[model samples]
Target chain A: MSVTTPTGFRAAGVTAGLKASGRPDVALVVNDGPSHAAAAVFTANRVEAAPVTWSRVAVADGRLDAVILNSGGANACTGPEGFADTHATAEHVAGALGVSSGDVLVCSTGLIGERLDMPVLLGGVDAAVAALSDTGGPDAATAIMTTDTVAKEVLVEGDGWCIGGMAKGAGMLAPSLATMLVVLTTDAALTAPELERALREACRLSFDRLDSDGCMSTNDTVALLSSGAASAQVDEAQFTDALTRACRDLAMQLLADAEGSHHDITIEVVGAATEDDALSVGRAVARNNLFKCAVFGGDPNWGRILAAVGTTDAAFDPRTLDVSINGVQVCRAMGVGDDRSGVDLSGRTVHVLVELHAGSEAATVWTNDLTHDYVHENSAYST
Target chain B: MSVTTPTGFRAAGVTAGLKASGRPDVALVVNDGPSHAAAAVFTANRVEAAPVTWSRVAVADGRLDAVILNSGGANACTGPEGFADTHATAEHVAGALGVSSGDVLVCSTGLIGERLDMPVLLGGVDAAVAALSDTGGPDAATAIMTTDTVAKEVLVEGDGWCIGGMAKGAGMLAPSLATMLVVLTTDAALTAPELERALREACRLSFDRLDSDGCMSTNDTVALLSSGAASAQVDEAQFTDALTRACRDLAMQLLADAEGSHHDITIEVVGAATEDDALSVGRAVARNNLFKCAVFGGDPNWGRILAAVGTTDAAFDPRTLDVSINGVQVCRAMGVGDDRSGVDLSGRTVHVLVELHAGSEAATVWTNDLTHDYVHENSAYST
Candidate 1:
């Protein structure tokens, strides 16, 4: 139970026959709330999908009664007709729920540059509404998956309130956001501004730090809705902490299931002048193909790591830098230190620690190793 | 006859016993000139190799008497010992040629973070100096190779003068320069400043635009030396054009021989507000792993192209963008246009043209497709 784990929420998933594989492809979640408060973030990419444009405006007034999502064809780059299709999708869902269309949000994912099959989608939406239940969160999560091997869900229980979230993503993951769709629900007494603040802060420290492939997408959305059914006024700090935990849990799940990835690597950048500098340095190393390939081969080639770090303008003395793989310090002061053969990388998780010795600030970024399956999976994705 | 195609220059290649494969690993080139004028460029990566640090200062006075290059170990990330090794090699060369130690430049390639075998290297340097002759250019071209499959050579002839060049590189190729070692010789009567101007312009248009893997190296150098043996001065513009052609030719050769690459991709961005904008957009697409994978799989996934273009800050309207793969306009006005099936990517060379429709300026960036072999080669490279 993810989105529906919170009180006053109902969800459903149904088959739409939109996918060639004939998988369940449509989902709906509704909030019956004493307080209708919402916050959302979409892809920063300029070429946004039709549903992203539609939902962005829908949540501008800080209210959302429902969210509808689908996984079959990304309704992106389909022009004006695509936007119209998104509007029609929300309108159809609103008509079934007896709510205004302006209070509904929409999301779509899959292959880009294609139109959705509206008749089939509407038929599935009708079925989903009829099958809505408080235990439908698992099905909803599964329905929104493209290449994901498993569904992701999280539930954080407070004293009298709770936060629940579900997410779906597989590939094309990067910083600024991954190619993912996420929905969160909370049964707590909170205003829209409060929810927005917590959501932004949580996402910045969680999803924004995951750089699986260094490829941003055109249809990434994360949203949260609140219902005052719990009638408990929780502290803002508590809410933010729970939300961050949920997002990070889901992000790690996404990293584990990233397409064709063999290793989940965590790059911890310490001793920086600023958090931004640490992030910049971490991202540079995370995106370096040479470094990623070395990790995949389990080669402790610390020189590639230093070469990557040197590409950034972060505050660090090159001669004073240090790097460690796992628990072994392979490079000391930018030179070979301990024996590389002592460090083992034949595991699923790898840790790389970089000490800049610039200051006290630090940041961590998560990524995956480059592998043959990564190339094969992506190369044959659309085909 | 690449470097020796011009007059008043001698070069030689010798076995250094540095590489495990027993390949010729040492090369020497000297200017037996009436006028010795030189200009050189090194990698912009801040974590530079010891040879790069030494050569950059050696050519600062715009006069180079000789250059010594070695393969099998890049003296990088080896600390003060690496710098000392480079200095000792240059001094040895200077002693043998009866020139100032400061007038000799050094270059090294292969694996980083390792020390050179001084006794073996010094003996090979002696052999290289004694074996140096005007007809030794071919052997010199073959010596400074890391993973390169073929030697790169170019010769441009003028009315009374000629320019010749040779280069070696294969993987770890990217913008800001590839992991390459280059030597260019000219028999024309030119000054140091004029040669610098021409060399800069030539590199800016050619080597700078080739970004094979988006991984900048710690050691990349291109040096141009003028012997002034022909005693005939050519127009600066003409010399620049000839040098640009030679650089472009070598750059394309590098692209063709890039490790594990299946296709050579040319991303052309047109109708931008400025040339910089065009290049910015082109490089964005060139470095996008998703787009590169699509090309390797022979999939005309134009949506990935538009998605990559949207990530840039270049001047462009998202809705007005157009993309064509080969001769087929697969996307128009940022939507599906001609059928994607009409585009063919079965050939070795693939062209992707993007029309921003923001202005008239344009630029092109060259890259290689991501393939399984590329992953295989790089993953097991240092192992």
Candidate 2:
């Protein structure tokens, strides 16, 4: 799957020197003529980035021409200067593309409260505009990354429509839609309203459900743009299905790359009294740092998982709950899992499972193990 | 404030050779009283330790003769073997004290799913009984610790009544009350039913409010026993006041000893629309690892804090929220805290204040910084 496999969109990624490591820092995607219908989701964090503000204003008309993204300086908490920086970037992009400035969207991700060097950002925008081409998907994917080890790109080819997406985020990922900045491009002739509905539904099942580090970012944004360049007419269900699948793939990639993560765990809570209960239990485990650390240690500490589940309001009889670590049934009927013999946990990754035995509904959440690196990364710079 | 300061309660602590470090591992506390009123609370986590199982049952009647506690083996997830181990430990302690095993409460903390060595545990029990004396409080305090830098104890004197408590827990602390195992002694006479009411209330305000690492322990217990040696008649309010003060003091001590903690931060959400809203916002910050890490970095990244606050269900315009870091009012009406100049996060301990400006109600939660040692201690273990 690739993000630009959709019909009318053209994409490009280029370096702007935003990151000292000299990786690509600017990504530009454009709807080269046709329906520029668009919908965007911004971070729930009250501390928004400059780009979030600019994008929110651009979506006022429910139509968009392009998205310009940068990675490195978050351009957040820089006061009025950050706002001016965003406005300048979007205005420059829109002027060059001969579209309304309001039609140009922007996004940013990096260290919070840091200012972006305007000269580098402006030069990067110029390079991005010149480098824009229909098939430059890899470049676009590589541009919007701060600390991500690898770029994320997903493209879906449908009968009537095509969808392509690129996302950048590794840490500060959790529910509340995670800390990602994702852009979805489609060649289907869809309206802004329809795009909003489909995007929200797809996100609910994919991006919104991926809980990695349990911390939300101030610069989270997801934008969906339609190029209206497809030849066939794909139905709504087909489009949404393809969209969801693409998002799921990217979300999984992001989870795998979560910082300081030693384990890629998938917690499946089944037999819950309700789907809500299942999710509640799943989230409780996903957000538990201690439990995550235990997984990092390769310890099948199912007791920690059980404790996390019990802390939730979800209804269940502790004695009735069943737990399995890796495929070993270690807790049953609230008593204990049967297999405690010869348990080995000296592995890089581990899987833990819990069953409520209360009902038939189930849900799975993906997460990473907590490790010493995570603590070192978070604690070392105490100024 | 020390556990030994309480009236009419005898305690003994000794190293049982059960721990590889040769540290104190076993403790005994007895009430020489005219009343047998006792109350207790256990970990809300469904996966409880073996000692937790026995103590939970024994506390149902709210009347206990003695409490036997040990460190080094949590007796959790040992399957049926763990339960049998709990029974044997209780039986051994009972034999030494010449009391029914059911009259003794047991608590153990350390590694999960590890079986207790019966010989070492039994010998420790005998030593605890022989050394049980009111003056042995300090020994008992040292006997029940795992990763704790210092023992936690509190003493409070009220009119005709005294309250004293001791607790042990470094990690697995958060809502549902951090994983603290506490034992309280009182000289006031009360029924088991009354003691339960008071203890629950005290926990709600004290232990339950601290949201440290957000990990609930599998083996948490709080037992309160009355020695019935108060010199004069006392009112319920007087007894509760003293008990509450003691519990709060112990809770603070626990926070002070929180493993891998750089800051003992207090997040106060004021002017919320409701108590639940205030609490949700407060807890949202308490649980935000990025914000915690940012504070650790001394960046005064108030934006991350606001971003965390925005993700909650609490109602407030993002821009209208006011945030303060280290007593420096950083964000006003949803804007940047501007003077990032004076935001002092240099201290190992930090306090953050968030004003929602939605209502008059306020809520506070305590938590610690995200640090490397926490990860090291947790990740190095393999169960």
TM-score of chain A of each: 0.99, 0.94
Q: Give the TM-score, chain B only, in order for the candidates.
A: 0.99, 0.96
Q: Candidate 2 chain A: worst 10 consecutive residues by lDDT?
A: A374-383
lDDT of 1 by residue, B1-383 (tens): 48988999999999989999999999999999988999999898888999999999999999999999999899988888899999999999999999998989899998887788999999999999999999999999999988898988889888899999999988878777887998999999899999999999999898889989888899999999999999777999999999999999999999999999999999999999999999999988988888898888998888888888889999988998899999898888888788898888999999999999999999999999999989898888887
Interface RMSD of each: 0.9, 3.1
Regions of model 1 farther than 4 Å from truth: none
- Per-residue CA lDDT of candidate 2, range B199-230, in tens? 98888778888888888888889899987887
Tens digits of per-residue lDDT for model 1, A206-229: 999999988889999999999878
Q: For model 1, report DockQ.
A: 0.78
